[model samples]
Target chain A: MAASASASAARPLAGDSLTIHVSSRPQLAMVSALPRSSPPTWRLGLGRPARLSTRSPHARSVRCLAAGGGLAPEMRATLDKVVASHKVVLFMKGTKDFPQCGFSHTVVQILRSLDVPFETLDVLANEALRQGLKDYSSWPTFPQLYIDGEFFGGCDITVEAYKSGELQETLEKAMCS
Target chain B: MGVTKEDVETAITSSLSPSHLVVTDTSGGCGASYEIEVVSEKFEGKRLLERHRMVNTALAPHMAEIHAVSIKKVLTPAQAQPQPEPAADKAQA
Candidate 1:
């Protein structure tokens, strides 16, 4: 019994370190690739699936490559697919249940209060996606809400829209569509 | 070091030429956060997202240092005008 408990505790610790190692690998690649003066633009239009099939391991590396060379067209394609994946999508700092930032949390709460089913992408997990999204939306902040494949706005706009009843109206329309 | 409230105001003023503007430093002297309310003719006919984009673009230079920007309000001069309250008249009736 004692040995089993010790092993179980060690298992979680090993898993935690493994996760940290995997996540840090991409950051190291990003830092190294940043100083390369000439962007590998030639890598464009090659080997990248127009849409990521199932959040493959290659996704992070692809995003890292894209981030290194500014907003690559491939990155734009991926973002396009992501935004259009659902009727309501929120590219936020953290997941819906676990928002890392205050603004992100506020928006999550508003959406929850509205009782609308939405999808959230955690930008904190993926640095490349975070940078890519900033360029993709051209909006400087997180908690970017998208309704019906449109860039709705950030937290403040969502709150204002919620207050003014416009968000519900728009959501109704989107749901109907 | 981060951007000042005055710096944000100047950037918005020069870019959008707002008739009314308020920039509040919400970062407790760190200057990394702000709450802005801008009323400009440039916002006329633009959607809320576009208006916010205008503000973001205006502050693009300083956005790196600034952590949070809550654009509380973005309105055209016309939209900013107080509307006549018809509810008062109805109540009197």
Candidate 2:
């Protein structure tokens, strides 16, 4: 065991174990579902995707739910960029119109009633994304809200914020700029 | 199977040692949903978001089995005392 350990230790750079996910998978199904161009390069640790960042008028943020957790290093960067793209982003169980979960629906209603122009990503559509979000936010629940690139909270918090008019205040701040 | 109200209370009590706790089985007959109200000294100076996060972390072991968790309220003992909300709170609204 010691001999093997020493032999492997001699292997330089092989033990980085950074868990980098250069998704050379060519055809990521989730990207295809997106309305606009979501070139894999944007997530390929490149600046070209930053160009997609500026070019994304409205469609990108709505569908920009990247996977997290085990395959998160690259996905995390992508998610950061995605969250930054929108003033209000909701990572929920379903879209704005039809929410699969009650908690998600409640959040949707709150956002709608508040008249906050937000984007929603249905987590049910992607297994990796659904699982990754639990790890990413550490909240372990759906209907997670992000305002101004910061995680706001889940349904209960949103409800509380809405009642306190804090949600309105926060949305105003986010939308103002 | 999902967790019961007792299990949730036990978890929170052991982890946070809250001064007050109320766990409601909002899942009706099922054990999937719960509404939690907790008051802990640990919440002193913490924002509502952090308090809720602490409660959620306490229940992390059972998160997969349990479905929805609505943290109805989280207060420090001082805040939980018999008193009206501060005027500044109303001013924000």
Candidate 3:
């Protein structure tokens, strides 16, 4: 609590609680609102209304496929750097020649059909990168396609984008850069 | 025999100690495509990509049996919440 005061002193609050500290506030409120004898839901109200933040907890359960790589914290940072390293990168299940997963194969096919040149990371070989990717993209599914070092979407999104020619357009822009 | 769902769960639970965990059999029964959602302290400070990597690593032994693994979400218990609809998804309708 004391640390909060120091932090608050540095930045003025737009609301009762500082926006930066909003998440922490909910956790704290949830702690104190606990009545030793009351029902759990009563405690729920006192805390910050559960936020449906962009990052959802259940995001990873979107598809039931096994991840292939090991993603350590440092490896995660490295992966981020790597994704940012290239203009176009895809964290796919397999490589361009032999896609291990159907979703991955779909994206590879789409990329090829578009005549786009992109780098692919085979998560199967490395464990750390695979696990780290789930968190980095905030996506629950695989066949994650990145353009200009940014996550475009998963296989489904890629397929749709390819159909509409958006995927080709985006890749064209990336390749030129 | 390929890796089983129970094997994947055990690896994840043992590695991440997630507060919430959901494992789905996308393969229908063959154990190929699978999806998982895990909320754990291990995910704190890590980004979405990294969190996925962690889950992937935990399931390494079972990877051969898996075909398409989709991670719907990975978050710290504190960060865990329902997902927001993507802007494109909203626009498409």
Candidate 4:
């Protein structure tokens, strides 16, 4: 990693222009790079056809969704990658250690009690993501939990599932899969 | 003006026709927060998530004014018959 970093740094001024372009057109770069990096995971979880052919129309629709409190395509695609990349992911009001909401804190405790590795994204820090997530999950509440790239539910559901041992069973299944 | 406990009750009652319903205005008087327990036939074949969705859809119009809605219990009438206690209180603790 160090050698690669140094090698990139040593490249001539021609590489600088490419870097600038990638930074300016981040959404385009992400859309183009997505197919190569993480298509299979996205396909397996959602079962939707990959957005390979209808990129422009798909992107336009995503923007429309964003306007309606849904996710922008780039944000949607990024979330697709995020959820798929982890065994568990939580989008909550605050970090795991310092939850901002009582409901968010409860979910964090339950996950900790289960003793499984999980990733959390603080929605309070990002306004766009906070709103977009409600539309994405079709659930209006926060502390949204995802297991195996599928939305499990929010705090109440998680607590109920935990009480019944269903959460443990599902986590075990996800762990193995 | 924000949403009211009565408004929430009326919405869920009209929509779900729940046999047992409790709407606690946890937001004091502001009506921004609530905890609900509902039992209805509509939830008979649904999962917990779907049951919550039904309640949410019923309250969709008022959702803009309400800041928090904690759906404490979602049950079908048959499932609710066996337990007389408020399971939500125990779960929260």
* Cα distance off (Å), candidate 2, residue A54: 12
Candidate models: Cα lDDT each: 0.68, 0.66, 0.57, 0.69
Index of the highest-lDDT prediction? 4
Residue B68 of model 2: what lDDT? 84
In terms of TM-score, the best-performing candidate is 4
lDDT by residue (B1-93, candidate 1, tens digit) is 789989999999999999978788888999999988888999989888778888988999999999999987788878777746342343234
Q: All candidates' TM-scores? A: 0.71, 0.71, 0.43, 0.75
Better of 2 and 4 by DockQ: 2
How displaced is residue A25 in candidate 3, in Å? 45
CAPRI grade of model 4: medium
Tens digits of lDDT, candidate 4, A1-177: 111112223122111122211101223333355433222332112323234423323121111122123233334455555555567888898788889999999999999988998888888876656765676666777989988767788898999999999999989998987
Q: Identify the candidate with maximal DockQ.
A: 1
Shares of reference contacts reproduced by the candidates, in order, are 1.00, 0.83, 0.00, 0.75
Question: Residue-wise lDDT of candidate 2 within B9-40, one digit each (tens)?
Answer: 99999999998787888889689988888889
Which sections of candidate 1 miss by over 4 Å? A1-69, B83-93
A-chain TM-score of every model:
0.62, 0.61, 0.57, 0.64
Give the DockQ-based CAPRI class for model 3.
Answer: incorrect
TM-score of 4: 0.75
Task: Note the DockQ of each predicted structure.
Answer: 0.75, 0.68, 0.05, 0.63
Q: List model 4 lDDT by residue over B11-36, tens digit each.
A: 99999999988888889898899999
TM-score of chain B of each: 0.87, 0.86, 0.81, 0.91
